[model samples]
Target chain A: MKVEQILHMIGGVGGNSYANNSKLQEKAILKTKPMVEEAISDICNTIHTNNIVVADLGCSSGPNTLLVLSHISNAIEKHYCQYNRKQPEIQYFFNDLPSNDFNSIFQLLMLYEEQLRENKAADYVNLYAVGLPGSFYGRLFPTKTVHFFHSSYSLMWLTQVPQGLDEKNCAQLNKGNIYIADASSSIVYHLYLNQFKKDFSKFLRSRSKELIFGGKMVLSFLGRKNSPAFGDIFNFWSLLADALNSMISEGLVEEAKVNTFNLPFYAPLMEEVKSIIEMEGSFHVGQTQTFESNWDPFDDSTDNFVINSTLSGQNVAKYIRAVLEPLLISHFGDDIIEDLFSRYAQNIARHISIEKAKIVVLILVLKLKE
Target chain B: MKVEQILHMIGGVGGNSYANNSKLQEKAILKTKPMVEEAISDICNTIHTNNIVVADLGCSSGPNTLLVLSHISNAIEKHYCQYNRKQPEIQYFFNDLPSNDFNSIFQLLMLYEEQLRENKAADYVNLYAVGLPGSFYGRLFPTKTVHFFHSSYSLMWLTQVPQGLDEKNCAQLNKGNIYIADASSSIVYHLYLNQFKKDFSKFLRSRSKELIFGGKMVLSFLGRKNSPAFGDIFNFWSLLADALNSMISEGLVEEAKVNTFNLPFYAPLMEEVKSIIEMEGSFHVGQTQTFESNWDPFDDSTDNFVINSTLSGQNVAKYIRAVLEPLLISHFGDDIIEDLFSRYAQNIARHISIEKAKIVVLILVLKLKE
Candidate 1:
């Protein structure tokens, strides 16, 4: 199988509804839940609603997923008790592409099932969760059914790997790696822009149909400034593939089948995202905020195991496992793999700065008009 | 006859080669002499030249014509005496359309004959002032024959009245006035622009042929800013024509004679003029200056004779004299002519700021490549 096919299969795996590996996936969900809760609060205030139906689109399997559900439940419970009135019922939906590991998401929900029942108060709060597996580009719910919607860290993923990348005209020889030529940037940008416009317009239309009057949505995602100097991030995997080819050519490792890879998603500039939303015109802008994060801030980051445990989980570790051995062998010979974690620790202690590991997030909250 | 043809006829009258009456022509020439001397001094200072061959393109019948010639002569003579070297020879070619009043120009030149004989320096000065009556758009002399060229207040005369003004579409309404709608501002501007580009290109090519390696051309004419608010100036003539139609309809004027009337010349923007000169890549920009004439100055208490006299000797007064008087009388009644004049004079007295009457002058110097 081609390298692109392998990467696509992995992306498809994350997108599917049936995958059940919850233990490894739950950590990211837990970490992101508080941020999602803050976003939901802002969204509620924008809509002037104490009770609202919410959906987490692209809600992958993780402990963080239930934490988000719990946050919403707590906010609604507090609003009712303080006002001395009937509490609003909550219906939370977990959505992803059909290929995502939903069993893991389902298991995490089941674990929280008992706790939700025990805390049920007057006006009968309900915890109903369902897995929705489909492309988010089109209508997925009935008209005027949703009150608020939220999505995060997902919009930057391209629908498919770029075609014709292997063609001689598509790639140019630059130093040792095959880099894109002058016309490549425009071609890729247009290709991705067409897909994004189609998908985003459909998403807005679908949401507009489903949203009740005064409903709100909070979305956080990766974007980029429209400048010639910034290359489209869709090419990240292709560049990595080229680097791998160089390592393979140097006889760093035996030829082994590798089918799956991930694209790094970064937050885009505010202007580009605003342009798309404005073009759709279904929602009025409320608030936009940008925040930064440092994923790996340890002083001695050279201990690969410690850093991996702190920042990411098994999925990243598994992917890096294949390349790590080959990469270390090629650069420092076979014996260094055992001591590589110590070397990384020392290097991190000596040179790593907190600023270098930061990630930027941009949040946009919009309210749907009647 | 078309309006343009009428203007052409008037312009043609100033091109005649022999004098019909030398005495009256000499007096007009004398009256204009001082202005010509000042103009020559200004030109010399602008071009930084003490000795140069100066030709007046469209010299016509004027007392000031000899002054420009004599000024060139004096500049050369003074330069030679002061530097102890041979003075520059002056070859003054006075040009006009074939039908010009050249007899007057020649007679005025003859009146300076005795002064030339007494100078003694005239032998070395070598003044050869000749009449070249033809279109100034094409070559009239040998290559590199002249050093300076001047034309004042002449370019405003259009080469011909624009064609097709009598067409049905050119009439804005059925009342016999030409319609500005069909013959729009752009249409009029472009019509003149086409003629200018054609004529000026030929003129430049011809002048380039006659001008020495380093020569200067000074041109002054009536112009206007290309603004829609100021469209009144260009459209006013049409409105006056409409007023004439009103008079004819009322049995006060002859309709048959109106066809003979025409706008004399084109008024181009400063940028347009500069572009035409620079298009051939033969000349560089030297200076451009614009000023508006103030027709009134007093606080509405003085007689209006000053403003009236200023307009009397010019072509503008002669062209408007026929239509203006009747239009005023018909509109204001015979008894009010004095009142009309008094109102105009009062307005002038109140508002005759010097800035209003200023003219625009653009000077360009070209260096011929060997």
Candidate 2:
């Protein structure tokens, strides 16, 4: 299935829904607040227009959806207040795949507006929020219209699965693997790397055209600290593939389905991400950083001790399920979802108890070329 | 409950959904095509910018949601081609209540874009569709940003049900009626009229700030043909109230609930609409017309004979239920919806079999004054 058509965070406000289980993403937004504030300051200093257009690309439905926008607007408001200048109007575009739950985002906005009204400080800014539904791989705005763009935890999702992993095209390209797992051929690694290069380059090109001169973007997404294509990020998916393999042994899921089902995702090395941006040639790379979060998002302890690995396993499983369940259901059918995730949780519990596991996240700030 | 919080057309693609039952609204859109086309031409001739910002206020989700935008863009494209001018990019903002099914509209937009790609003529036009979820009774767009605005069958929905029609505020004001029925006192009639005036004036004032000088708006909504406090439009709500009263007699619904329940809607006289625009002093009325459609939207016969009263009644009931079910459920509860609409169908059938009922629709073209 086309990733844009099928991929979305679990919608609505249920236990497994993205709205409820999105603290990991919320943490990412919070972690990047300084970068976001810096970007806003740059925009305010450079752009002279009365209306500032900002977009949150891949803004899945959740509390985190507006968290970034609120940061940017508040920063802009503070900057104008510091200068004793009339603040410009802020027009925010919340963008995601067409399948994303924008209705929930709009609902959150009503409460946000109420909160803003109660705060007299926010009166200096006139905020307009619009939901934009489209893939970031293509153009979404008029040329030179957007002033700032922010996307979080979304770019790792490639436009589609690497072109030639299917059994019909090339047999055993990545057998018994849903991603670039350890057992797969070296060719599987290159296939994913190439896809990420193409998709990320396309994303940069599209945003470059949409952003005005010196327009800024702050993007944070899943990435890898290790130089190799198969990094610690693979372990997260490896456990999932293992769970699927166990189900296949019991004849609960078809082996062919497992063999063909690959995630349209690639956690790029930070070097790979920078190289793609440079290759795209339309953006000037700015501040870039990489950090690690534990596999269990709820486990914030700095120590390596695996305290309650079972609970951590379930927490990790829940976070992944909130993001990946829709894509999994599309390919494997939902009947396998409950059984597969439960097995995946057990596999995660077994592995993390022996060794501490963490996933790498990368942040980048870029500006449009003159 | 506030109308903005609870009011929305029935969502999703089901039998009772607004998407499925919006042929009535679609007909109104098609009926107002010439005026919409004229408004587009006026915008093209007057505005010099390369980007045309068009907004459809109260753009409820359905096939009809984009129908008016499509007409406006096609007209703009044709206008540019005839003049040998490069087509400017068209930015469409679909505004509705926060509870609107924006996800469905976004899904339809995907297909719409695919269709545009297939159409060779559309290649010259850059189309951007954004969902703006809010009420039109307030400012949605920035000052002097919107070039054209179109709203069909939506303006009649008042911002709220008139205040003080309740038993607590005033006893027996509009006793036993949810609207200005024939038996409603003159005080009740004035209450509805005064609310419509306040809401419509607020709507005009808000749009005036948003629309650029010479910006155009084409609005079509339910209106009154007869010059009286009680008109044919009253018959529509009176029948619905009759249905509720019957349920009250059967103890299926509470009498206090029916007494308090009032539609956040008004069917104004054409003169009342004109007076509001003139009083608001921002928009100059251009072209105005009135037309009628059968209460049974399926009945296209101009001679006004009920071909199948039962079938026509059911169709009418479905159309109304699609638009009003959420509001009804919010106040009275969902348990009474099916029974209420079914009983409403029988009441409509009995009345229309003898009288051949029709509802008045008013169309107005307004241009923003400098």
Candidate 3:
């Protein structure tokens, strides 16, 4: 089964996939704050209403789920208060996959609301929050109900692994690699691109319906620039391939297995994103800004991602493992995941020590076409 | 709006309701395990199905929520292994109000599942857990789907604070007190009794429909026994009333406010429970046992509740405040909650210092009536 079906299924209950190693994701939330506040500030100036609905699409369960809500609320409140306008009732719709850790989100939401209510010293802040558990690849709300939509580091996920990589379609099409590596065939690249086009178009199509006219969405996620350097998307996947290659060499896993497996992921370049938005014809897309974050998950530094000489590749490996292990385990089995990630971390650290490694995130603020 | 409607409203999010003060509730969970396991053991033997669905109704968001599920799972596993039978897949449904911190439960659920899977040494477990967010007083699951049921320390909440004590009906039906106090009239007692009867009967009716034939349920909740000499429901409410009396004398709060206010709580008498079970006729009611706990929320001693000589009534008052402060604040205002609970604690300390105080909890194991 693909990700949509097997979500929280194999990792079942204990899988540390998202809940355990969410530090990098937390950093992603932090890095995107300016873009988020910028979008909110613009919306506050233009979108005048007594009721404001803010949706955090693909808002996976964790400390980060409620972070964006508070930021948006504060920004909106700040703008209204500065102008001496009555603050509208803010309704926060925290949307995530049904498998996302919503229980934790709800628990934290209460605690957050408690803190907000106390700080505001109001009987009620007129803030309402609810969990909409479903896939963001499809529609999730009453049409035109949502005003502000925010997502970070989630658009990289394709609805499913590219259509043809398994034995069901071919014999290890992307040989000795689970995702795009430097050695991958032209066919693999094209297949992934086609899948990305389909998924991104569907994503745009779905979101376009839910957001109100002129509503703003800040979309930031892992993507590629043309330069496939050691620190970019190309290197990240290549390093992971490097880890799997060691496993294959050690005979821990069949080379055939790695060849057959493919990640349900695709990193779009800025040009590709522009083409899709132009091709889709739904959004007045704003200028896309490229952001560079550290491969080191531990690096909470909002400053430039300077790879400290002491920092090992394991930090990046841990971050990748936290997000990707579940899918890997689903394909390669649990026996290989720990060793694969450990070796992967070492490989990444070795490479990055020689060269600065970074992940490129593409941030775009889209306004629904009036 | 009643307790069910306003929930965290008047008390505001800053208010420390049962959801906030879960350590004591965790203590309640700890104090009532043998009974829980006993019921589980009996069900494991009697209910022979390939699948077992266990539902924890009123499973408030806290550290203790996932505890009960683990205890039930381990006990079932133990029972089946002892009999040389294959263990069935257990589906756990964590049910609570939409407002309950379900996020904590879900987050903890994964951690718990991870621990269980590790302990069992199984690559994958047959267990499935899902959050069922709704009220337990109504239909929650597929009819006749749930096999075993458990609820702890939550049934005391009468769906709405016994009707007619509000301004809409009249001025202070139960004069000079909030709950059933020594100063309360006969009508006040009867109103609470009738409300409890209705709510409990509805609870049984709802569960009876959901549970399979011969399915068993273990319910442990706050109640009162006839031996109301020193420590019982009698003094707990009276102590709270004493605090309010002191407040009235201080002129900090209007006596009319105290007279008009009432708690959305009812401590069922053992006889009252027995009669309700017999009257409902849905379950073959088993022997009902009464357990007493110290007014001090910290006391987990199963041995007779020995009130510490130095323990002031404030100890008990604090415990009550932690659980009931939200409801009281809703009836009164935020300004009085802190001061009201402070005086309540002092009054309770003074009263209980002269006399011992304890809380009575009634435990019952019910079998679906054939």
Interface RMS for model 2: 1.4
Instruction: Please list the residue runs of candidate 3 whose C-alpha ends up more than 4 Å from where it truly belongs after superposition.
Output: A7-20, A227-231, A300-311, B1-370
| Global lDDT scores for all candidate models | 0.48, 0.88, 0.72
Instruction: State the lDDT of candidate 1 residue by residue for B19-59, as single tens digits.
Output: 22122223323433344444444444444443355777765
**Chain A TM-score from candidate 2:** 0.97
Question: RMSD in Å for candidate 2, one decimal?
Answer: 1.6
lDDT of model number 1: 0.48
Pairs of colliding residues, candidate 2: none
Q: After superposition, how far is residue A187 of candidate 2 from its true place, in Å?
A: 1.5
Per-residue lDDT of candidate 1, residues A1-370 (tens digit): 1221121112212422213223222333444455555655554555554336677776644554566567666765665566575555465666655444444555456457646646655323344455554446554454565776777655654444234332334433222222222334565545445555656666777788778776667676655433532433323223334444444566642223111122212234677667878898887877777654333322224332343432332222233333233333433456534443333333333332222332345677777754
Q: Which lDDT tens digits does candidate 2 get at residues B1-370?
A: 5899989998989989999999889889999999888889888898788989999988899889878778989999999999999888888999999999999999999998888888766434399999998888888887788999999989999888887774445646776888988888788878888999999999998888888887799999999987666666898999999999999999998888888888889899999999988998998999999999888888889886798999998999999999999999988889999999999999999999988988889999999776
The TM-score values for the models, in the order shown, are 0.37, 0.98, 0.56
Model 1, docking class: incorrect
* Number of clashes recorded per candidate: 59, 0, 8
Q: Point out the worst 10-residue segment of candidate 1 chain B by lDDT.
A: B4-13
Per-residue lDDT over B148-183 for candidate 3, one digit per residue giving the tens place of the 0 to 100 score: 898988888878867666554555567776677766
DockQ for model 1 equals 0.00
Local error of candidate 3 at residue B230 (angstroms): 23
User: Please, what are the lDDT tens digits per residue for candidate 3 over residues A103-202?
Assistant: 5666566578669768876644456566665567765554566789998888888888788764545646777666776777788888888888988898
